[model samples]
Target: MLAILYVSHGSRVAEGVRQANHFLKQCMDQINVPIQQICYLELVRPDIQEGISRCIKHGADCVIVQPILLLSAGHDKRDIPDEIEKARAVYPNVRFIYGRPFGVDDSIIDILVERIHEKHSGSVQNDSILIVGRGSSDLETPRAFSRICAMLAKRGISPVSVCYMAAAKPLLKEGLELAVEQGPGKVYIVPYLLFSGILMRTIRKSIETSVNRFSFVLCKPLGYHPSLIHLLRKRIRESIDYDRLSAQS
Candidate 1:
């Protein structure tokens, strides 16, 4: 039997855990093979250590650590792998495979395009889009945002720009201001968040109260999308394939 650990960036916000768990369950239910356990990395209940132990107890002969991050950065590239190393040591008999982050994949782009169409089907007046993300000091974070911008462009709507909520600039509000200056009658503030939480609510509030309130439309965060599950499964399979090739070598 195989165990899959879906790791996420820890958040102090309670809703963050709920969102991840919800999606984990949804994906696990759909997968043909069983998922032995699901766990978090930090800032929430049942950390990675606890999760790994549960997998071992559940008869997981092999473990796959699937990061729920969008890009390879500090957490995806470094921290998560380090933790997996520690987990592997504790569960010596268990073969562990670490998967890639969900980067600028086609499935994700499809989801984003669907979101844009759903939000503005009736009113997509060449409106400027402001793709918002939880900014990271990691360079890949902004690059991910840019990739999304290019994806949107393929659907006939290039974003006015990408902005961060916390780390990089222009901040969400500043991005909105820029959209206003661009003279678009409507501006969509699309959150590149995985879930709805306090920060998302705050973003909505800010958009509602902005000086250009009349032109802004708020889209929901990405949640429980099947496309996301496909992305995860692909990464898991890729990791398995890579490990197999390494063994043969």
Candidate 2:
């Protein structure tokens, strides 16, 4: 009667979509729900409508829609809720509970520290870290991102800075320039991205032209991790519990 639908902002790149699917599949064993499904917001198969339909077909009475995103941006806010409204028109009786994304958790910063260590493990004190964010118009996006950056900074990773891919101040070029100005050390460019896509490629292309190739290390995006799977499991549990409490009250 309960279903967990994991929603990701899909990509034009097949490998990006594949990576999202593979990551959710990894969650199957760890999470216990009657019916679990994966869907995308755009540029991929099994869009949100179809995902909801499938849950109904499988006899789910209460569906927990979980956004598999790093931040609580437009997709998690306006877009997905809009789609859920359509489903509501069709399934007035079925309960739908929307859940949160990872959203600037401390554990996420730990993964980021590990990512930085993948390349610049030697002397974080000297390393200047640049975090590349997928920007959002929602004011909360940058605020939350800044908090993540601040958390990373408190780790004593000197001069940890950030920039947006679009729709915000200090774009990638500026971020790289600032990091370069930090002076005389390896700058690890950390993409606060979950999967590989046009954004990742864009970051790579910018690095190739804008900076000395040898002086900077392009660290891997925060992709599939066992820890993330556990986090999603927590999200599902908390969502369901809150809904139950709300109904009782």
Task: Point to the candidate with the largest lDDT.
Answer: 2
Q: Which tens-of-lDDT digit does each residue in 45-164 have in candidate 2?
A: 799999999999999989999999998878888899999999999999999999999877878888998998888657776668888998878899879877887887688766788889
Candidate 1 Cα outliers beyond 4 Å, as residue runs: 10-16, 122-125
- Best TM-score among the predictions, by candidate number: 2
TM-score of each: 0.89, 0.96
RMSD of each: 2.2, 1.3
75-162 per-residue lDDT for model 1 (tens digits): 8877888888898788788898887888888888787777777788864556777778878788878877777788777767765478
lDDT of 2 at 112: 91
Tell me model 2's lDDT, rounded to 2 decimals.
Answer: 0.87
